[model samples]
Target: MYLKCGLLEDAEKFFGEIPLGNVVSWIAMITGYGKHGLGKEAVNSFNKMQSENIKPDAVYLAVLTACSHSGLLEESQEILLRLCCDSMVKPQVEHFSCMVDVLGRSGWVQEAKNIIECMPIRPNAGI
Candidate 1:
């Protein structure tokens, strides 16, 4: 399978062939791109899903977390900001976790700490 073999291209190809991709399929494709260190590709997948009328769920957000791992500041920040403004997706710990992880890794530890401080749900210990 794509996951077992880490064949992102093949995975995406097959995904594109799917007639009715549900939320789960969308998440899988995005996660596949992310796992392959393709943050922009993951975001593109998210955009494609949206363009095709797929509503992103929390799992989609998780896939987008690859931006943090990949250190894609602008793209990640844009998505986070959009999510915050949309009102459909509330900010959750995992969301904050991705942001914090990105910020901290990018040498913006102070800003990351501030974000954690300002979060509605206080970050769990050991963050």
Candidate 2:
């Protein structure tokens, strides 16, 4: 697709043409933006998705990855907090891994270690 091909502008234009875009469509856009290092744009798309009442499930990881790659430490933490509070979506190990990466990348190694220590789930090899 255009997004996978790195055609972000074309992807956006095509996405906009959908009459009733679903959560999957939004995820594609967010993931594409994240992969392309457009963290702000990814967050904006996430907010827009929420405004439309499309509850986030596992998509938090994508946003977190975006924030991590872009060095948006605060934003990543905020998203993790929101994920923790959302009863409908349980936080996965992958989510925690992304948080650790974000924190560590931002030079918060101690905080990252604390998160690893305090997390209910066991840390995987990726962490």
lDDT of each: 0.78, 0.90
Model 2 C-alpha lDDT per residue in residues 1-127, reported as the tens digit of each score: 8989999999999999999978789889999998899999999998888898888886788888888888888888899999999999999998888889989988999999999999989999888
> Which TM-score value belongs to model 1?
0.90
Name the best candidate (by lDDT). Answer: 2
The clash count for each model shown is 0, 0
Please report, as a residue range, the 10-residue window in candidate 1 with the lowest summed lDDT: 55-64
Q: Give the alpha carbon lDDT tens digit for every residue of 73-125 in model 1.
A: 87788888777776667777788788888898899999999989987777886
**Cα misplacement distance, residue 30 of candidate 2 (Å):** 0.7
Candidate 2, superposed: residue stretches over 4 Å from native: none
Stretches of model 1 off by over 4 angstroms after superposition: none
**How many collisions between residues are there in candidate 2?**
0
Clashing pairs in 2: none
